[model samples]
Target: MKAFILDHYKKKGPLRFGDMSEPEVGDDDVLVQVHAAGLNLLDSKIRDGEFKPILPYRPPFILGHDMAGTVIRVGSNVRRFKLGDEIYARPRDGRIGTFAQLIAVNEADVALKPSNLSMEEAASIPLVALTAWQVLVEAAALKKGQKILIHAGSGGVGSFAIQLAKHLGATVATTTSTANIELVKSLGADVIIDYKKQDFETLLTGYDVVLNSLDGDTLQKSLNILKPGGKLISISGPPDPDFAREQGLNWFLRQLLRLLSLKIRRKARRHRVTYAFLFMRANGDQLSKIATLIEDGIIRPVMDKIFPFAAVNEALAYIETGRSRGKVVVKMR
Candidate 1:
């Protein structure tokens, strides 16, 4: 199969289009005919070896994780789907190679595509939507009438986070530049803070949860807006120590994570709140729920741009600008 291959990890490395072996399906996996793939910062980070510690991928590996397509073949163990089923998945790291013409994925990680969206739009939702769903709905268990402050409201995760929070009846407060405030507003953000002009930390308080996806400084500042027992969930670096220890990482890794968490925990305690990192897991059940919401017309997919499959690198470069209103996608089929 012809796929975009990553031969090396470099800051500005390019993806070369070439033929790669077709994936062999496992008894628990299904082979999908690629229709479209979503471009995410994770894709770029993995390409450049930025996530070596958390998600290590060796060189000469195919890249990409977010994808939507049809099931060309299904494993005997897969009972939930059949051949020709329209599905999507955010594949596990080291196993993802959605940039290719086909991908074999675990049935547990794949869900039916939302009826309301096209393949391109469905491709855009998995990674970001799952991140938002897990952090707000699963981890935080946000309640109606509660408030959530979502940073970068116009970005991929933020856009979905805002809408989902609102869907759960939470009051959504989001930060975006003046240019994109309208965009965030359309996505159901109740309060919009122009990040350039307003300091959200100073103006907002009593938030039930802070959905953070930015720098360490911003992470620390997010604690201030929460109520006494509120929680702060960060998807970025620096995992919370308590959770890290519970994960039982190696001694060396645990120690390193401990050092990073000390400062975060201190701030959280000082503000009378909880802090934790959210690494979204791929669950077919949860994704199917999200797809149902989309099919009901309660949520919509937002995409900033679409590049042909061969222009995968160009799409990555465009996303690196961090100015996209929504997802950047790659058309594969």
Candidate 2:
């Protein structure tokens, strides 16, 4: 099979396209023929060795997180899906390799694709959509009539979150460039702060939740926007002790994370708001619900571009620019 292989971790290196043997499917896995795959900042970070301490994937591995394709075969235990089923997923962390001609995903991490979407669009949803779903619905438990501020509203996770927050009946506020003001508004953002012209901290207040997906400084600034007893959930972070524990890191790594996040955690406590660092996990059930929203037209994907499979490196470069309005995809079929 032809696949892009990361021979080694380099801060600015590109993946080498090569041939590798097909994957072995487990009893609880499904073998998928790749149709399209999504590009994410996480992919770049992993390639650059940023997640080495935690994720620890050795060199010479395929790299991709989001995918939409057809099930070529299903394991004996996979009763929910079978051959020819259209599916999409962010394969479980240790099992991800969607940037290839085929991948074997654990059945529990795969979901039927939204019937209303194309393979490229479906590929864009799993990672970003799941991030938003985990933050707003699962972690924050956001309620109607409340207000929430989602940073980087034009980005992948931000775009989905703004729409989902509005669907949940919460008033949504978001930060983006002036050029993307209308984009976020169309996604149902009640308040759009042009980051190039205005500061979000000055404009949003008394919010029930603040979803931060920006830099450390931006993460700190987000804490002020939330009201007392509000929640501050950061997907990009100085990982907190809780996240380290969730990943089951060793005592040294756990204490290191605790110390790294100490200042921000203290600040959150001082403001009487709770803080958590969310590292999204794969869940077939959550993706199924997200598929329902897409099929119902409650949430539509906001795509930036789709590159051919041969342009995988180019796709990753585009995402690194931090300029794409939404998700970037690679068509493999």
Write model 1 residue lDDT over 1-333, tens digit each, in one string. 989888988876888889999999999999999999999888888888876766667778789889999999989899999989999999875588999999999999999999778999999999999999999988899999999999999999999999899999999999999999889989999999998999999999989999999999999889888999999999986876655665556778778888887898888888889888887777888899999999988889999999998889899999998888899999975
Every candidate's CA RMSD: 1.3, 0.6
Top lDDT prediction, candidate number:
2
Residue lDDT tens for model 2, 1-333: 999999999986999999988999999999999999999999999999999999999989999999999999888898999899999999999888899999999999999999999999999999999999999999999999999999999999999999999999999999999899999989999998999999888888899999999999998898888899999999998899989989999999999999999999999999999999999999999999999999999999999999999999999999999999999999985
- Candidate 2 minimal-lDDT segment of 10 residues: 199-208
Model 2 TM-score, all chains together: 0.99
Error of 1 at 16 (Å): 2.6
Candidate 1 clash pair list: none
Clashing pairs in 2: none
Off by over 4 Å in 1: 242-248
